[model samples]
Target: MSIRGYLQILRPVNALVAGIAVLLGVLVAGGEVTPVLFLLVVAVFCITGAGNAVNDYYDREIDAINRPDRPIPSGAVSIRGAAVYSAVLFLFGIACAAFVHPFCFGIACLNSLLLVAYAARLKGVPLAGNIVVSYLAGSIFLFGGAAAGTDGLLLNLPLAGIVFLPMTAREILKDAEDIEGDREGGARTLPMVTGVLTSCRIAAVLAAGAVLLSLLPVVPWWGWWYLGMIALADLVILYAVASAFRCTTSACVRESGATSMLKTGMFAALGVLLFWALIG
Candidate 1:
């Protein structure tokens, strides 16, 4: 396979974001940057890349219908090649995690397994897949904080909640976007089971909850910088919520770009957290 094909299969941008989230976890928990933290970041990058690659492999049939330009569906990478690449990346990630700390290594192992399971099975289950995805996203902070020590882990709990709620909402919207492919692939997602309107309502509630949780950091140690930035982030999420409410069907949700908007808002919130953690 070509280098570009391999890279495309890895979804490097998503993996890089996950790696950065790990770094933010360390920073927000008051952990210093160290060689160990760097290793943990690399570990997360590789693992996330591996997960994406494996997901591509498992979703090849669905992608053929929903995302024909994807590496596997486009014939940029062979199925076997993608599988091998994923295994290699998973190995490298676990090796890197093993050197960080036992707890971090454990998290890495557990996450790796969950990623595989999600691609193979849980992805088809209504609501279960959404929750798993949310947990995996939030656990990046926990994984980073664990690398620093116990206190770092404790300090990151609230940060994890801030991440979890919106991610769950986004996952629901994503399922809505992919409903046609999911239905053809014999998968039943939340939107498939509940209808897009009901699913969108649930997603809106979750986004609203995340906005509320985003306010809690100011109560602890954050100040005006966090308040202003987080308020902007909240507004972005609220806009996504409004978009969700307006979507009555899968096509409407996809056309509204609500899923991508939610992701933008999540990234904005993450950037705000990272900035404040660095300044403080």
Candidate 2:
């Protein structure tokens, strides 16, 4: 397979974003930007890449119908090759984490297993899959804290909740988008079981909750800058919330605009954290 195919299998953009999240967590938890922090970022990135590869591997058939252009379904990569790549990346990621510290290594190991389980089985379950994926997203912050050698790691919980709510909403929207393929593939997703309208409502509520949780960080640690940045992020979230409410058709939810809006909001919130770390 071509190198480009391998990169595509890893979903490099998402992996890069995951790495950034790790760094933001480190910064927010007052972790010094040392070699160990760098190692943790690399570890998180590798496992995220592995997760992406394995997700494609397990969803190859579903992707063939829903996303025929994906690397695995489009003849760019073989199943066995993708599996091997995933295993190697996972091992490397875990090795990096082990070198950092016991706590980080433990988290890395657990996250890796959870990623595998999410891709291999949990994705087929309604709501459970959404929560698992959200937890994975939120855990990146915790992983960052552990890497930084912080005793106040629990401080990351508020931010984790902030991340979790929006991500859960986005995953639910994604499920709604992929309902047709999921149904054909025998995947029991929220939209497939509860119907798209109900799923949309649930996602909207979750988005709203995320908006509220975004303010929890404005304490002695964060100030006006955080509030201003989060307010901007909230505007985007509001737009996404409106979209979810207005979505009467599955096609509307399936379009990239719907989920893209939510992603933008989440990343914008992340940018706020990075900004706070730098100047606040």
List TM-scores for all candidates, in order.
0.97, 0.96
What pairs collide in candidate 1? none
lDDT against the true structure, per candidate, is: 0.89, 0.85
lDDT of 1 at 237: 91
Model 2: runs farther than 4 Å from truth?
217-220
Name the best candidate (by lDDT): 1
Candidate 1 lDDT, 1-280, residue by residue in tens: 5789999888898899899889888886778888767998899999999999999999999999999999999999999999999999999999999998888999999999999999999999999988988999999999988987897788788888888999999999999888999999999999988888999989999999989988875324577767888999899998986886868777899988898889899999988888777777
Q: Among these predicted structures, which one has the highest TM-score?
A: 1
Worst 10 residues of 2 by lDDT: 216-225
Give RMSD (Å) of candidate 1 vs. truth. 1.2
- Given candidate 2, what's the lDDT at residue 255? 61
Candidate 2, 72-178: lDDT as tens digits: 88888999999999999999999998987787899999999999999999998899999999999999988887765655357577778888998999999999888
